[model samples]
Structures are given as C-alpha cells and as structure tokens.
Target: MKHARPLPAYMVTRYHGWKATTHAENKGWYRRLADEGQRPRAMIISCCDSRVHVTSIFGADQGEFFIHRNIANLVPPFQPDGSQHGTSAAVEYAVTALKVSHLVVLGHSSCGGVAGCYDMCSGNAPELEETGSFVGRWMDILRPGYDMLPEGDDEARTRALEKVSVTVSLNNLMTFPFVQKAVEEGTLSLHGLWNDIGEGTLEGYDPDVDAFVAI
Candidate 1:
C-alpha cells in the first residue's frame, strides 16, 4: 500500500509566503471579483509543458484568464463518446459558462508529445500493441499534421511537425460545436500563438499574411 506524503517543509513555507503576498496585494481585487462575479476576458488552451506556463507567458493575473492544459494542447472535435472529454469540457465551460470573449490556442517549440507524434509518423518508434494507450491515442489527434510533413531529419522534422500541429489544432478548435456557434455569433474570437522557447520570442498567427508574425 502507498502512503500519502506531506509536502516538504520548504515548499510549505514557500507556499504560505506566496499566499500571504498574493492576499496582501490582491485582497481588494479578489473581493470585488467575488462580489461582482469573475468574468475573465479570455480562455487559454495550452500544453501541460512545465516550461510553457500560460499565465507567465501572457502576463495574466489570477482571474484574468480561464486556462486548460492537456498533452500537446490538442482539442479534439466534439462528439458524444460517453468518455471523459477534458479539453472539450473546458472549452464548453469557457465558452458557454464563462462566456469569455477570446479563446487562444497556445503552442510552444520542442514539445515532447509533438516529438512523439513525429516519431510515430516516421515509424521510428515501436508499434503500439494496444490502440488505446494514453500517448498513442493522444498522438492520433496530430496524425493529419504528421501526414502533411515531408520525410527528413528527425529533429528538424519534429519541429516542423509541431508547428503544423498547432495549425491543425486551431482548425480542430473551430470544429467544436460550442466554438463554432460562438464564433458565428461574433461573441468570441479565436487566436493561435507560438512561443519559441530558446529564442524567447512570441508569435501570433496572422490570417491575412498566412503566417506567424512575431508579436
């Protein structure tokens, strides 16, 4: 049997200190938000990568954005599968319940999940014995983008595939019923963002230019 472990003393101390600071700086704002009700202006769909934190990247304060994180930040098309729909549920809540004005898909460079998809596409990885393993199934979401990439060096190919997957995921987001309806009504706007980790640069999708331009 596994036993639950308490948080490390250092971490506990750090957390309490951070909480005190937060409360000191934002107590009034928190009260107002609670009283008036939270109405975040945006929802961010982001990867579970520790290096690609959405709040820090966007300089968002607490209650400023509704956030959802998942493997590779993929948003599956809406379907009634009687299965858990983590990302989709967040989208539904953000659009339907929160009614956020903006929904942004945030992608980052050197994503391991995206790299795994590229490896699966190149047939370099061992074949999956089961069709339903978590990583295998999640990689399926990026299969179309993988199919679109040209065969080449593994590293370069993976990066390119990751970039393409962002575009694919953006398309997938539009296919969601709630997202489609919101966009059609013009109550919500969709944006795609790419963050280059090494370069510390951020880029936004420019539909008019058909490219990602540095922001």
Candidate 2:
C-alpha cells in the first residue's frame, strides 16, 4: 500500500512562516553563538509532550537552554554499556561539555507516559503487545515507583504515583557519576519541577524543605 505524502501545503506554509519568524527573532543570538559558541546557563530535561514545550513555556530563545527530552522526562541510572544512551549523552554534554550550572527535570500534569505507568502498575490492562517493543522497556524505569505505591482506587493511586515518579527520576539523576561529581563539587545543581496544566502553575523542588513549592 502506498502512503500519502506527509508534508501537506498547509504544513509547508506554516513551516515557512515559523522559519522566517525564528530567523528574524534569533538572528543576533545565532550570529553571536555561531562565532563564540553556545554557553547556556541551564540544562532542562523534559518530556516529549507536545503541550509541555520547554521553549514556549520558559520563553526561551535559541541557544538559551540545553534541552534533553525523552518519554516521561526520565533520567535513567548511568550505565557503562556501549549502547544508545540519548538522555545520558545529552546530560554529559550539557554538564561536562557546555558546563551548565543548573539541571532541571521538568515534569507536568496529564503526562501520557506517566499515565502508562499507572496502567502497568494497576494490572487492569495486560502488557501492551502491539507496540510492546521500546515502550515496554522505557516504562520499566517506573516499576520501582509503581511497586512502592499502595493499592487503592485508580484515580488516587495514579495521581500519587505520578507525583512520586518525579521524585524517583530526580533520585535516578544522581546515579550518574558525572552528575554526582558535579553536584559534589558545587559545579552543577539538580532541580525537579511539576507543571500544572489547568492552573498554569509551576511547582519547583525545594531541597531545604523537601517538597515542591509553587513558583
């Protein structure tokens, strides 16, 4: 079966408009960065959710943020195995190479990947067999959190699990040797953020208070 051409006229027109605007807005920054290289102050690890766009949310322009995105905005424990570690690679580059002072793990409400973890933990649904390849492996990172949650109603349990999962991912960030050393040497700091979609509120992790406070 022949597939239809993906790029339609409307998409092409929109892309052109975006390209023009982006170029005009970021022209100076691009020139300066191209000459001197990017030295972004922070690195943001966020989810690959269309609604939770880091640039748009933070009002960041080009070369402003070193971003690393993946499913559920998860940061996996560092491993030495020579495998494809996209998130880890980005972290290493951002911290060691770019020397970003702050690393923020940005989580949001109504996250599909987090919702998937809720489904897996509850056992209401079987292991996804159709697209059971990468998603299954990716969702495994949330298993420890899932197991830790107490049995209860789906809504309450899922909400609790999602919040706890943010903490879990934050803990996992320290497992990386680079991140650990950076934090120990006071070169880099880690922060966790939870964005409420409905309320347009941002809650940031307070290490001193050991809680997420609205910002």
Candidate 3:
C-alpha cells in the first residue's frame, strides 16, 4: 500500500465533479440502492476494453446490471479445482447469490484479445505464443471458436471471429452446473451479443439461425 501512487489529478478532479453533479442529482437513488442492495436483472459479461461502455450501451444507470469484464469476455470451462478463478467467481455470485434472470456475454468488433488469439493460433504472434504470457494462456479458452471461423478475408474473418468469441463464451457458461440448472429450470437465460463499436450497432446470437443477427 505504501508503494502505490496517489490518484492522478485529472481522475481525482473528475471524481469530485461526478460526486457534485451526477451523484448529487441522484442522491436519493444512490441511498436507496445502498440500503436495499443490488438486485440487478441481468449479469453482463463484457470485454475490458475501455471503449466498450456497458451501461452507456444499454442506457442503464447504477444498480441496473451486474457487470464482469475481462479480456475477450471469455468464460473458461468450469474446473472447480482449488484455484483462483475470477470469471467463475463472478458467474457463481451472479447466478447463486444474485439470481439474475439473464446472463449476457458481450463481444465487440476490433477486439484486441480476439485478434491476439487469432494470431497465436496462426503462428504469427510470437509474444502471445509464449507459455508464460497470461493473455495467451487466458485466450486459450477461445480456441474452440477459432476452429469455427469461416473462410473469408482478414477483415471479415476477424469480425466473424469476434462474434464467435461471444458464442463460445455462451456455450462454455452452460458447462457450469449452477448455470445449467438455472437454465434448465427456466429461471436463467443466456445470451450472446456482438457490437460494432464504430457503428454503434449490436447483433445477437440466434440459435435457430446459428448466426449473429442484428438486434
């Protein structure tokens, strides 16, 4: 704690600004949220990319959605071994503790993690190919999706692969026992979504069509 640096001036100023503006305006709402606790309807799993604003995308306010973000928005297969699992812990909490009605895996265009995976699989990214690279190891979860990538130009393939990452995460989420049981009981629903960041358009996975359709 002693080694950690103080907050940057800009960030501190922004926090004060928000506290005086948005937080002041919504004081009652914030107080109610703190008193009653959050009962978010959905748990949104999104990428850690700064450009991907989960709340802004849905026009949502505080306490509306429980969000978990990570590289590529990937969800690894359930292992349950005595090991630290950030994403799994979040999923468990959202399903068991929160009882969220919907669990959404959100992927987006121009995703660096997905691109890194593609390069790693293609033998092009030496840095990520290293066994010690955490990002490379984490991205191994998306290998199944890489297998399903359709033949196309680089741009098209990358975009299609982005959606594939979402699809893969949705499929992997079902591997968790709690998720499976909740889904089977008709209490929890899983969804996959891909966003075109530049265009501000979202596409949803359609099991019937086996593809991402515009939403």
Candidate 4:
C-alpha cells in the first residue's frame, strides 16, 4: 500500500486537546464501553450537512445512538435486486442485527439536497437532471415529497419539502419487510423529526395532526 500524507497540524492538535480533556475525563466510561459491546437503542437517519450536529443536538454520549447520515437523509423504497444500497443496508443492519427500538428519520431546514430536488423538478437546475449525476439520482428519493408540497414562496416551499422528505423516508422505511415486521410486533418505533438549525428547535411529526409539532 502507498504511504499516505500526514494529517494537518490543526487536526493533530485537536486530537491532542481531546485526549487531554474529554477522553481523559471519560476514560473509565470509554474503557467499560470497549469491554462491553454497544447496544444502542435508537438509529438516527440524518442529513450529511456539517451544520446538523446530531450528537450535540441530542446531548448524546458515545454508543447511545446508531447514526447514518446521507444526502437529504432519504431512504428509497425497499429494493432487493442484489445490488449496492447503502441506506437500505444500514436500515437492515440496524433493524435485524442491532434490534434498535427506535428508528428516527431526521431532516433539517435549508437542506441543499432538498433544495436541489426542488430545483431539479421545477426546471431550475438542469445540471442535476443529467443521467450521470449521482446526486440527482439520490435526490430522486425525495421527488415524491416535492410533488406533494403546496405551491408557495421559495423559502416556504423549500422548508415544506424538507419536512416532507422526513415523511417520505419514514414511509419508505416500512417498505422494508424487516422494518415492517419489527414495527408491527412492537419491537421498533419510527419517528419523523425536523430541526431548525438556526433556531435550535425541534419539531416532531404528529400522525394524528398530519403536521410537525414542537417537541
């Protein structure tokens, strides 16, 4: 194997800082966790946006939540064609192997992926519609959500679709047989969440009201 370049100075300094502080403070807790295998109770599907800090928002410690971040936090319908599917694979592992009690589909406001889908479908982003675009194909998972959004100002439409994307993923998660079985048997619960990054507020999808309510 080829030798890789060294890490940046700032990254190395950050590691040393963490080792001296957080890691030092949590050494015993970390050691216990390493001795015992992780048994996380929840699986969080969230966007890959750097602004969305999953652990920070939940105040979660290590081994508390199994998180999978992808573009738009989108999950496609269950497809068992013996092909590569990263999101589905994670869902399968979390449901079947991890036996997580909760599966949360987390979306956030001002999502670039959601906005790209809106633009692609609304004839504003021609480049995204190209056949070879990976992001375009990925954003297709949220197309159904975009179609269901009510017409409004650009900002309103974007925010609405962002929340819709969470619903779409939650709906699609049921298409997976294992997920459906777990949910039916009361072994797993599904949740839809939308975060306002700027406001630092969270809204949860209420099935009865058919809207996101502050939690």
Compare the candidates by TM-score and give the number of the best one: 3
Global Cα lDDT for candidate 1: 0.84
lDDT by residue for model 2 (57-163), tens = 88987788998888888878888699998888998899899999999998888888888877865674466323654776787787788877767887766766666
Q: Rank the candidates by lDDT, best first.
A: 4, 3, 1, 2
lDDT accuracy of residue 177 in candidate 1: 83
TM-score of each model, paired residue for residue: 0.91, 0.88, 0.98, 0.97
lDDT of 3 at 33: 99
Cα-based RMSD of candidate 1: 2.0
Candidate 4's error at 92, in angstroms? 0.8
Model 4 off-target regions past 4 Å? Answer: 1-3
Question: How many steric overlaps are in each model, in order?
Answer: 0, 0, 0, 0
Across residues 1-215, which tens digit of lDDT does each residue of candidate 3 receive?
Answer: 78999999999999999999999999999999999999999999999999999999999999989999999999999998999999999999999999999999999989999999998887888899788999999999997777888898877887888998998898899999999999999999999999989999999999999988999
Better by TM-score, candidate 3 or 2 = 3
Model 3 TM-score is: 0.98
Q: Write down the TM-score for model 1.
A: 0.91
Worst 10 residues of 3 by lDDT: 152-161
Q: Please, what is the whole-model Cα lDDT of each candidate in the order they appear?
A: 0.84, 0.83, 0.94, 0.95
Instruction: Give the lowest summed-lDDT range of ten residues in model 4.
Output: 142-151
Candidate order by decreasing TM-score: 3, 4, 1, 2
6, model 4: CA deviation in Å? 1.7
